[model samples]
Target: MTVSRALSKPELVSEETRNRIEQAVRELGYVPNLAASALVTRRSGVVGALITTITNPILATTIEILQQGLSKAGLHMLIGETRFSPEEETKMLRAFLGRQLDGLILAYGYHTPETLALLQAARIPVVELWDLPEGDEPRTPVGQVVGFSNWAAGAAAGQHLVDCGYQRPAFFGYEDARENLRWQGFRQAVVEGLGIEPLRYNTSAIPHIDDGVAVIERYVRGELEFDGAFFTNDMPAIGALFTCQRNGIDVPGELGICGFGDLPIARVASPALTSVRVPAELVANTTVELLTQQIKAEGVGAMLNDVGSELIARESTARRSS
Candidate 1:
């Protein structure tokens, strides 16, 4: 009992006793069994985080920050990738829950009914990262959201293109709920604000640079026409830029290109790509803070933390002085 108390709650024990216990532990090389400790305390010191994909640099950076923050709080993070599939997400969630996780962080807000039921039954701290649902009454599987509006970010990019005097613009991205929201925002702004119906091309799924290249190739073949294009994410935008270069299209002069998620590569591209900077660190830190508060039984009810986004204009979309 004394050793367990000293190991679990060191502050409750006397310094001399704690030192003796620590010395004995060091001499014996005794590693405490976390599983046994958790069984007695009913608290697993483990948190589960699910993201759409681990391959994305922006999401990877966010998860890295989250892991660091949780580590400082004496919590371990187990990550799973869902690949934007609700069934896969639910399966991962069930597996994590089976392991007795103390909290959960999900990159996607949408959820299957089974997943929602499981989460509600678990009654653990849940945080949904990334964008929320569209419209004023946004519905989330969990009440906690730690991200900015994808629509607003998309709108800002669209507005910038319009302000730059691009009459004919298009939107390009993959078919995902998050990207769809961005596309809706971009299309709404371009059509409503400028009264110009922008062309849209939503690829099948998990669009790569080759997909972007193919779309631009189609445009070059006279199948599509646009003076500007707002890519939902940096990957496709960078790809489109490469396509334009190979086809001898003068960017910003002949075709203005804008991307979201102002990733590092965007800044170093041939013509520095214009992009929307999502607050990745802020979202990760805020998620940890909120989850910590919940774990401590603090009153943090249905929180929505919008860290906001920024539009970074670069050579790809920089307007020349007449």
Candidate 2:
């Protein structure tokens, strides 16, 4: 009807004529080619996802959920891995823009200004997840932001320890901004919030179970007195948990341990771990939903969706008597 202009010229052609033309086209089975349609419409039906490191299991899990969510919405996900470098991330963003994707998602919260400008030029939806900086900034409705506050999770761990009557506590994690944020929050809560300065330790890189064992050994052998411990992520926490078990040190009874990103094994450990529960799958689903909305120009406003996380109580860290 639009092609024939019959609606405009109803007097020129009868309704019967318009209906006949529609019926004939439907019978012939003419399908519009998306490539040809894109030439005029300028839509690729593709979303770009940039992860900090593809090798990291945590990030891999997040991306897996994101891909499934995008696929269900009939959108394709284009993935790029930047090894925690700003320059490399910019290059990846440019490459994605070259493909003319509808939206972009970055796993690392940090992005260079140049890349931000380039994304702005592309005028597509952009999302940053997993440790966004805390500040007063405008929400990117044109894009979207979805994830939890690392600072809050850290504070929660600190408060849990305080509530459990652990006076002396220690913080252990990598020396990155994400880890730092958690440490900062933990510091504030444990020191200023609860009026006790917790001993802080930083690792050069991602702390594995071996690293956890080493830290605990150093503390125990060096006479570092601590009643509780908080780890950056579950890997190191679990590491320390087993290390304590093997050393014949009682958990909660002797030293309380709390971890972040309550992984699956947190509950399965000999003494279940008490840690912050980050909904990895929820982050993935929301990222895809925001991207799909951006692609469709659905006018969904700037998404600063803060999915609330919970603290799972397990045996790894239990309250102690004063």
Candidate 3:
């Protein structure tokens, strides 16, 4: 026990005892088996996170920040991508359970019925990212939540588009619960502000630069008539902007674009992007803090944090067409 104290919690053991333990470990060439130790201690020193996508730059940064925060707390992160599938998320979560992870983090607060059931039974410390909790539904098994309001962020983007005087605002993206919330919010705002339902180009494909380029290319070919649009995130907005330039359609003059996430590249892109800035870093740091607290707390402390978001108006949406 003293040897374990010396190795795991060095400050808890006296220097004299630690020195002897170190010498013994060296003389015996004893490599402490973490697997064996975990059985007794019930701490694997690893936290797992399930995400929808690994390719999204915004989510990628959030995961990086989360890893750093967990590392400081003496825990390593294990990440799993679900490719936006509830079944895949459930499978990954089951794998994490098998590893006996210290805690779990989920990208989305919502989950499949089976996933919610498993988490409810496992009783593991869990913190879901990207969206705030809707309720304590019998189906909602998440303990802590740290993220922004997807609906509100979307509404803000739509409202901004209306303010910028884009006559016909359109939304472009794929559908999932979270993204659909954004779409609903954007739709609500655009409809209320402009008294017209915004156009929607929904797809089953994942959001990508190529998809965006193709949308703009169609418009350039005189196929699509949307003069202004809001993309699910930055990729498509930038793609559209690029195509507009190639076709000589002036941004804000003939076309307006807005996106979410406010990725770093958005600020520097030609014509600059107007976007809804999600508090990704804050969410990551808070999720770590809340998750660590829940793991170590006497009572599985619960938190539902909404860091909120802001809409950044820029050149892309600066025009007020007369």
Best-matching candidate per lDDT = 1
* RMSD in Å for model 1: 2.3
Clashes of each: 0, 2, 0
For each candidate in the order shown, give its overall lDDT on alpha carbons: 0.87, 0.77, 0.84
Model 2 backbone overlap count: 2
Q: Tens digit of lDDT per residue, candidate 1, span 46-162?
A: 999999889888999998999999998878999999988999999999899988898999999888999999999999999999876665556664758888888898889888898
Q: Give the range where candidate 1 is weakest over 10 consecutive residues by summed lDDT.
A: 132-141
Which is the winner by lDDT between candidate 1 and candidate 3?
Answer: 1
Against the true structure, what is each candidate's TM-score? 0.91, 0.81, 0.91
Please give, for residues 57-127, the per-residue lDDT of candidate 3 as tens digits.
Answer: 98999999999999988788999999888899998988888888889999877688888888888878988
